[model samples]
Target: MYSKNVPSGFPRGFLWGGATAANQVEGAWNIAGKGISTAEVVKRSTNRKDFTMNQITKQSLTAAINDSSTTTYPKRRGVDFYHHYKEDIKLFAEMGFKAYRLSIAWTRIFPNGDEAEPNEQGLLFYDHAFETCCKYGIEPVVTISHYEMPLGLTLKNNGWAARETINEYTKFTKVLFERYRGIVKYWLTFNEINAAVWGFNGTGALDDDLPNDQKMQLRYQALHHQFIASALAVLQCHKLDPEAKIGCMLARMQTYAKTPAPLDVRAAQLQDQLNLFFTDVQVRGEYPNYMNRYFYDNGIELKFAADDEEILAKGKVDYLSFSYYMSTVTADDNNITKATGNFALGEANPYLTSSEWGWQIDPVGLRIALNELWDRYQIPLFIVENGLGAVDELTPDRKIHDDYRIDYLRKHIIQMKEAIQDGVELIGYTTWGPIDLISASTSEMAKRYGFIYVDQDDEGRGSLTRIRKDSFYWFKKVIASNGREV
Candidate 1:
């Protein structure tokens, strides 16, 4: 898969890799001293068109927790990666991955999120996983807390809205830093940190029935606690391993104006600012000026400790990392047609195509996002997650000819190269899911995004076999030639 002609701007040693989350990929939700997580109780949405947060009231959560049916709760039986880590990492090594981005399930370590001592079994699990990656020369980029908060935290402290949750999370981070200091060098403080403000289901909030004002307040308060936790985690990571690189992860919903009208432009800018606010706090270590007005106008007051500002300043991240699967356009008018993708909604872009899931396919927007992030933070940016989620049919011979996924990835990689040429300091690119796992949004296996396919369905029935797709070989070549053989 090597090309004689290498890409011009792709510097040598550019980290090419894949990404997965514990809740989305790893099964064994109840094994190895792992506690139940908020992700486990999230029921699948029947209506795909309107992917709102599943109604997660206390009663529903309790029922789902006690429910013994893995078929109904598919996340409970992910891809069984917990038991198949060695086999999966071998495949990643076969693809010549420079880095593998995966999250450490918080519950795996803490079990209940406030434990006085870490679970040795959970620590040993990651210790062996990272050791295998190191054996294959694959760097592990670990997300400290990726959506899989222990359900106990939500029930006990109302998730991150309570001030005590911050201390608990800091304790979790301290354990991680002290334990995995040598094995994992790259760290992400939170996965999609802004989702709490956006009311995403995985932000550790289980009460979707609250009033709008109360909901907004809760979301922002949780966001504030997460911000403090992220900062403190960065500080803790540096204290443990000075060579470690910590970053803040954002959803990166790049928005464009529909027209040249000032209102339209302002709308797009405001939408972009709303998405960038999370990264702004982490990278700059201070809240952006515009957020004060936003808070006041919305009647949202954030509680902060006296030393929170100082802690944030001291704990600024070393890089900016984000997941960019699609972009959205915004118009000033209220009657504009809307498109949804990656948990964000916006006006549809008539100029661009869309994925089967209605995610706008704008390769150029990736270049725009990279340039914007680089210009804003003046720090290295990592493309932690980007991929197409589509249905795949296995032929009788057990093969998948997914040219659409190949095209999506090729176009994005080309745009990433263009961005690098345009002076964006990019650290690496890790496609969202290297192997097919349970979909985060709908909890369906059919919404596949991977070079490798796992034999599973939405109803939790399959032989649990792993097969390499055509794009798997294609990606191996791309990585081998350093993005030259697309």
Candidate 2:
């Protein structure tokens, strides 16, 4: 298949761009009336094991909040995107970005979760940012909350555990919808609503010392609240601007069976079912029946309001979007040699190679995932986050030759085109961290994912310069050619 081949190339007006999160990109954390966020409390960790819940302790979190050291908490520095967004957006425009997917920091607006008024300064920042995107002929695809929430919500409103966050999140969305309704047509309710199953990331400021069972219960309950909140956000967006579209995002860790054994196949099926439950509630407008048995077995009784089901049905997402970092293999046994993936827990596949961070590379898995999602849900799909994270070396000539990233993306894009040829109605593909920003899992700047290289390091040193890598030029051509040149 080549550029002349129909359905192999991207469709007309297909958005080619990049994605970043506010808590991971924007520094000036406390400068412009920004309230503390749970992201700020998350200390830096280079060790992959430390990226888990083990590192998030009362002692560590308390010190991170009080100490306020950018070196220790690299996310606090975040490549200084707050000051350099103009330069960054210019770079994106140069790369011919038809769209730029970025999230709004909730604390930036509310300062605290339970505020009566939004911070004017925070509102102004995004207002200018959106205007700049429009000025550069780039469409801004916005995410409401991307893995970070106001610390005030955790401390006071009890985070997502309490149903109060549903109303609070609606308030935040209402402000955003009303503020930039026309400029930003595409919206995502949450970055990865399903990741709540693996708790403590965005669920709020619950004590890390809680029992395992209690923690699981809290996460599901919080996820329930968010489902309602997302539904409410859908209604708000429609009422504010009928032309706009709102979608739900999933960290779609496509799962595979470790072997063809019946037990392994069944285990993988069960895992996939559980993973799809998040989108089921959002898209199909009700939780699936299997959840009843799972919840009963797990002692998780989700409380629901009288009108929750009605609200869910009324606010079905306009589209379905997701991030596909890597896929995993599941087996029936518990003691299998596990993959080094920090997020999606699974056994390593023998046929796959891993990145520097241990995430398996699976281009074919993306095609399978696209077919599965298209058949499962008939709505248009968007690959809002897909990229390679590797350590790049800048040559003495101030050039970064990151052909590894280019190869990774090219393979994924080829599979994406195959899926489109399979008749999957994919609308867009935005590679994650188009510019170098802090890593969400490890909070390390060294684990870079940008086509454009950042000058900063893990300790937050360097001039914070934005230099285009070899992948940058390669991607520029990819976009200009509409996925044909790659």
Estimated TM-score for each candidate: 0.97, 0.97
Q: Give the lowest summed-lDDT range of ten residues in model 1.
A: 46-55
Please write out the lDDT profile of model 2 over residues 73-162, one tens digit for every residue. Answer: 777789888999999999999999999999999999998988988999999999989988998999999999988899888877668989
* TM-score of model number 1: 0.97
lDDT of 1 by residue, 1-486 (tens): 874544376888899999999988888988889998888887866755545546478788878978967777788888999989999999999999999999998899988988898899998889899999999999999998887788888888888878898898989988888888778889999998877875636457755678898889889988988889889998899889998999999999989998999999999989988898888899999999998988998889988899999988898999999999888888888888989888678888989998888989999999999999999999999999999998898999999999999999999999999998888889899998999998888777889999999998888888888999999999999999999889
Model 2: clashing residue pairs? none
After best superposition, candidate 2 residue 163: deviation in angstroms? 0.8
**lDDT, model 1:** 0.88
Q: Please, what is the whole-model Cα lDDT of each candidate in the order they appear?
A: 0.88, 0.88
Clashing pairs in 1: none
Off by over 4 Å in 1: 1-7, 53-55, 200-202
